[model samples]
Target: MRVVIIGAGLVGTSIAANLAADNDVIVVEDDPDRADQLQFDLDILSILGDGTSLATLQEAEVDDADMFIACTGDDRTNLVACGTAKTLGDPFTIARVKSAEYLRTWQRKHGAFGADHLVCSDLLTAENIVRVTGLPAAIDLDPFADGLVHMAEFEITADSPVASQTVAEADRFKSLTFAGLFRDGSVLIPGGETRIEAGDRAVVIGSPASVRGFSNDLNPSTTPDKADDIVIAGGSEIGYHTARLLEERESKSRLIERDETRARELAEELSGTVVMHQDATDVDFLSREHVDEADIVIATMPSDERNLLVAVLAKRLGVDRVIAVVNNDEYVTLFEEIGIDVAVNPRGVTAEEITRFSFESVAENLSVLENDQAEVLELELDSDSSMVGYTIRELDSELSGQFVVGALTRGGTLITPRGDTTLEAGDHVIIFVETSFADEIIARA
Candidate 1:
């Protein structure tokens, strides 16, 4: 595949790096320094010019590109760049925007901005935040097969019940599959006898109930049913959306905003959320509200520094879980290191959302894990697929890539994968495998 990306910012650079390993990737950036740096770093063609310019699109050979992505920080620039790219070629155009208003408009009118798909960072981040709220101890979670299957990554703390358990012992859930483990800085494909140690991040895929059950097993005390007190700091778009989503789930939440006007606006818009007009970073205000007793605290302030401050405060106040929205990719590790349970990066979410579209028709849905070390893919099997007639164990032995069939859905019914289970045409198979073999496995499926 040939991909042409506009704006070499964090999202663009991530997309380019992800695709450069398996596809022909060309990046366009207005900053000469960034362009040169990316060209040298990724060994991909980087053109220094304005992405919204027709001349710049031509220089990047947009006419020959299979996919065109506009993911700059500025929303208008990204939209305009996608529109401009459409004039040159009919490449599958994707635009990343922060505003939900633009996404609504595009949804009302297909191809409104010449973009085949639109990824809203704020909304995506909010959805991510809400998804984890339902499963305690999950650092990341995504649904597949129309929510029939769930892939979740949980950090195994020293006190976690499953920290010292073997894969076979932890595989108590009937529908759950232990996909992989992240130890230190590397990815490990686990077996039945694999020992799960402290600090290892375990990845699992299964039904929603099974995943929720697994979460309870990991930390029996902090189950979702007992996680009632949810507090969100800051009334930014991400915060508002997160509260709104939690409300949709019939979960009443509290939102704290420093600005009186924004708090009023949010209060009026969200019926189920209690909006508090107070500084989230103020220790006195937090103590007054008994935030220490809260089950979860999410920091979604506009700036990374503010979010960090609020997250640190929440941790110090004895909050059970702290989730912070880090806009800068570089601050993700920093936030996590400071005891923040989860650091949600908007650009990282947007990049993952857009990169999945690059898979075209091969994968119905995709989730990148551990910074692209592995991926979970949902694929609809074709009649002529090489894997159609083989059982799970047979495919495992025949396939070149190391992968685990997590779950399958046939005719809207969920099926837990087993060694003797044979695959058939039209079944939606969700598999977790190393990133390098994703394309090959998809091709065979």
Candidate 2:
């Protein structure tokens, strides 16, 4: 497919690099230096021009492109680029918008504009943080339909009640499907007699209500209380954004910063949260602040070494959860081995989001499932689509190993569809597919 990507920043270049291996990619950038850098880095076609200008887009031959993605850091520029692309081409357009207000108002006023999809980086990042931190016991979660349903990954600790129970005997997860179990780094598609042992990671899928119910059953005495006392060890953009998210959730958080002015500015912006002007690595200052009492400690300082030190200190100080934001992927396994509850690499997360968005079909948004083996894709049925008039059973038999119809959204209602259920035009089908076969499945559908 021919794809045109606007902006040559980190996000745009990352997305272009990921897609270039499989598609014809052209990156547009107004900055000559950045464009040259991206071209050199990724070996992709580069167009030096402003994305918001129609002439630049036309010069880039957007009309011949299969997809046009506006991913400039500036939200206004991205929106305008998307709008311009819609007017000039038949390509599926996507825009990256960071502000919540713009996303809320964008489609309501213009009805999808020329863009086929919208990516909200702030919301995505916030959601990713919440998924990892909100429930420390769960390793990951895949939210569907904006969080109404979820597929969650939980590690079986030695304390878990179902540690030694068989699938049938593990009454804890009654309504949820024990999708698969990972033990010794291999997946076991469990059967009724399959037994779960300690240290195994279980993948379960169900609605939020059912999944939470199952979690409660597994740990009956566990509290549903949200984290209140949070200690953030940086005031960078990502750190500030994370703190803002926590504050919005009514969580009490404090930012510890070495820079006095930046700390003061953050404190001003976040009136409810406390801001401390101190080095987060200072043991005396941390002790004075009672950092040990914090429910969670997040280290987002720019220096990876400092963040790692702070995380280790927080863990030693008895903080229930410690999360460090590190730039190096190589350090992720090392940090996890040392008991950091979570290590987030913003670049990796951002890259994953971009890759997921890049594969989105015009009729559906492609989301990566948390298990890392599959994807949850939503496909809108068109009148002439092959499966539109077919029953679920027929469709299942016709499709290959690539996909499985997980659920159907019809007339705004979600249904765990059965083989007898028939699909109709305009119905949205949620299919779980292996990434390797996603394109083939989509093409056939």
Candidate 3:
């Protein structure tokens, strides 16, 4: 597929890099320096021109492109670029929009602007925060279709009930199916005898009802805890976006801004949130405002130094959880080292979202990687395949190396197969294999 990406910043470059491996990609960037940087970093075509202009779209050959993505940080530019792409070509178009108001307005009016998809980074981040906060025990949660179905990651803690149970035995816990397990830096597609050991990170897929039931079975005492008091230190776009997200989740937040005019403007915009006109670095001011009582502290200020300082201070001040937005890649480890519960890089998060959305089939076709080398893939049984209607042990004859059929998805139901269990046509089977043997396994299966 031929893909044209506008804005060679982090998000655009990430999308280009990811798609370049399998598809033809061209990036259009306004900033000459950034465009040059991206061209130097990745093997993709770069066009230095304003993406919002019709001439730029024409110059980028949008008419022949299979996909056009507008990912500039500026909302107006992204929207105009997407509109121009739609006018210039019939290709699938996606726009990255940040404003909540714009999101609502765009959805209401001009709904058929020819943009195939609209990705709201603010909404994605907010949803992620809500999921993580709602289920503190879940290592990760990837929701599909606005929570219709979900893939959740949960670590097998010492307190987990199914720690030593086999795949078949643990299947009775709930109706959910175990997609894959990450253990010992390797992914394991467990069989009937495959045991669930402690320290294993298990990925499960199911509906909300089944997932909730499974979580309850895994940890009976687990409860949803809501953050009542939130302290946000920043008045930038990201900070404002975060505050709006928190308020939508029904959390009371206090936003600290050094600039009086900006603080007042934010205060007016976010009437429910408390806008504190003071420097976030002032520990005394934070203490005076009762930062001790905050359940969650979010530092999204522009400066990484100030964000790190405030995050560390919040951790010391007894905040339940601290999340800092670090723009620089170098500061990611520093934030973790300083005990910040979560460090979010908007660029990374946005890039991941775009990649995932773009490669919808890759998620199901590719295996879940525990490490960089090993992968666990779910393959569907073809009707004409030699392995169909054969038992697990019988099918082992054609396959090399140790392979296990972890779980089978047949007719939308998840089942843990035994050695005597037969693989039928149309059944999706999860298999674990080393990266070296991934191709062989897929081909043979």
Candidate 4:
């Protein structure tokens, strides 16, 4: 497949890097320095020109490209590029936007922007943040099969119940499967004898209830009951979305904004959430509001420095978990090293979401595992595809443990896979597959 990606930012560059190995990738970056650097570093072609320009599109050969993706920071630029590609070529169009308003416009009427898919970064970032709210020490979280199946990654601490146990021993959860483990910065496809070491990231696949239980058991310190008080600093889109989600759950949440007008607007938008127009970094204001009583503190401010400072201040005030929105991917590790419980990278998250559209099949939804080592895919079984009319126990040896079915949905009901469970046509199956064998699974599907 020949892919044309615009922006050459984190999202575009990453998609190019990932697809260059298997498909033809061309990147358009207006920044000459970044374009030159990418051209020198990557195997894909890079163009240093405005993406929305027709000449630039012609240079990138959009007419022959299989897919055109616009990921520039400007939503108008991305949409215009997609519309241009649509008007000029026969390629699939995808544009990344930060707001849902533009996406809604495209949805209300078909062919509005010539984009087949709209990837909203702010909404995706908010959804990701909300998923990790109650889960303990969850480095990543994804739901499949209509939320019946869950895939999550959590660190194994010394005190964790399954820290030192082998995969077989840790397979005590009735419906949970140990998908993989990350140790020494390498992904390990776990086997029966794969001993889980302390500090390793244990990835698991199971029903939502089972995964939630496992997370609580693995990190007993941050129990759901204890991790109740939620404090949100910054009235950004992410902050509003996070607080809105918590409002629906009836969670005790407080949002702080420095601007009076924005604070008033947030108060009107959010119900059951306390909105305060106070400087989050002011020691007196934070003390007056009992910052030490906060169990979770999320800093969603625009500035990285401000977010980091708020996170540090909240931690110093005895906040158990501090989540910071770090726009730069390089700052993710640094934020975690500096004691932030979780570092949310909107750019990286958006990049991963867009990249999955390329690898994920037409009938499948992809959820990447830790470090892109694997992906959990949910797809409906058709008569023409392989692996139909086979019971869980009847799977061939090569297809058995390498990938495990987490759950199945038939007739609007979810069924946790067992040895006796058989898959039929039209049944949606969620399976955990190693990244190395994704192509094989896709082939079978």
Off by over 4 Å in 2: 5-23, 26-63, 69-123, 168-175, 181-191, 197-199, 217-223, 369-372, 382-398, 402-410, 414-428
lDDT of 1 by residue, 108-190 (tens): 99799998889999999999999898886799999999999999999999998888899999889998999999999888989
Instruction: List TM-score per model, in order.
Output: 0.96, 0.73, 0.70, 0.89
lDDT accuracy of residue 372 in candidate 4: 63
Which 10 consecutive positions of candidate 3 have the poorest summed lDDT?
363-372
Best by lDDT: 1
Ranking by lDDT, best first?
1, 4, 2, 3
Q: Backbone clashes in each candidate structure, one number apiece?
A: 0, 0, 0, 0
Better of 3 and 4 by lDDT: 4
Question: Which residue pairs in candidate 3 have backbone atoms (N, alpha carbon, C) closer than 3 angstroms, thus clashing?
Answer: none
- Estimate, for each residue in 343-398, the C-alpha lDDT of model 4 and write its tens digit: 99998889889887887654467876654677777878888867787887676454
Local error of candidate 4 at residue 51 (angstroms): 0.7
Say which candidate scores most in TM-score.
1
Report the error of model 3 at residue 152, Å.
3.8
TM-score, cand. 2:
0.73
**Model 4: residue 362 alpha-carbon error in angstroms:** 4.3
